[model samples]
Target: MTDAELDLVFKALADPTRRRIIERLDDHPGQTLFEVCAATLAEDGSGLSRQTISQHLDILERAGLVRTARKGRTKIHTADLSPLRLVAGCWLGRFIQED
Candidate 1:
């Protein structure tokens, strides 16, 4: 991933909420907005509204961390790991020296 792309990835995952969402998506792929919001609210009693979650998804989408598609009336969101893995292999992987 390019430096700018890496920046967006880091920025998107920097937020705790966004990180949690990513973790959830990692566990369960192709989750709709309602499903994600429900799962998040179930885990956190504070109740993250659908709108808020949508905004978080927007940020993730812009960072290329997630992809969204329209499925009838609902929107399906899925995690995209190519950029993440590319960044890890290109940037983080380079930092680790051979044993």
Candidate 2:
């Protein structure tokens, strides 16, 4: 990924809420807005509003971290870890020492 794209991905993951959303979708693929909100509340009791989660999802989408599709009238979200893995391999992986 280009530096700008990498920047976007890093920026998207910089937020804890965004990271949680990524984890949620990673564990359970294809979730709606309401379902995400419910699951997050059930897990942490944060009671975050649907709007807040929606906003976070938007950032994830822009960063290529989340993929969204329309299933009938409902919009579903899924985590896309390709960018994250690319960043890790290109950047973070360099620091690892081979045994």
Candidate 3:
């Protein structure tokens, strides 16, 4: 990934709520807005409203972390793995020194 792409990914991940949303999508794979909101309440007990979760999802989508598909009238959101793995391999991989 390019630096700009990495920046976007990192920026999106900077928010705890967005990270939680990513985790939720990781576990659930594909979930509609309502399903995600329910999961957040069950796990965090934050009672975050659907609107708040929707906004978070929007940010994730913009950062190329979350992908959405239309199923009839509902939008199903899924986590994209390539960007996360790329970011980890790019930045976190530096920790492993090859002597």
Q: Write the per-residue lDDT of candidate 2 for residues 14-76, one digit (tens) a residue.
A: 999899999999999999999999998998789898899999999999999999999999999
Q: By lDDT, who's the top model here?
A: 2
TM-score of each: 0.86, 0.91, 0.86
Candidates ranked by lDDT, best first?
2, 3, 1
Q: How many residue pairs in model 3 have overlapping backbones?
A: 0
Q: Compute the lDDT of residue 48 as modeled in candidate 2.
A: 90
lDDT string, candidate 1, 1-99, tens digits: 778888999999899999888888888988998899899888876487789999999999999888888888877888887878887798888786454
Which one is best on TM-score?
A: 2
Pairs in steric clash, model 2: none
2 or 3, which is superior by lDDT? 2
> Against the true structure, candidate 3 has what lDDT?
0.88
In candidate 3, which residue ranges exceed 4 Å CA deviation? 96-99
Give lDDT tens digits, candidate 3, residues 1-99: 788888889899998888998988988887999999988888888978888999999989988899999989888999997888888798867876454
Model 1 ranges with Cα > 4 A deviation: 97-99
Error of 1 at 77 (Å): 0.5
Clashing pairs in 3: none
C-alpha RMSD in Å of predicted model 3 compared with the true structure? 1.8
Worst 10 residues of 3 by lDDT: 90-99
Task: Give the winner by lDDT: 1 or 3.
Answer: 3
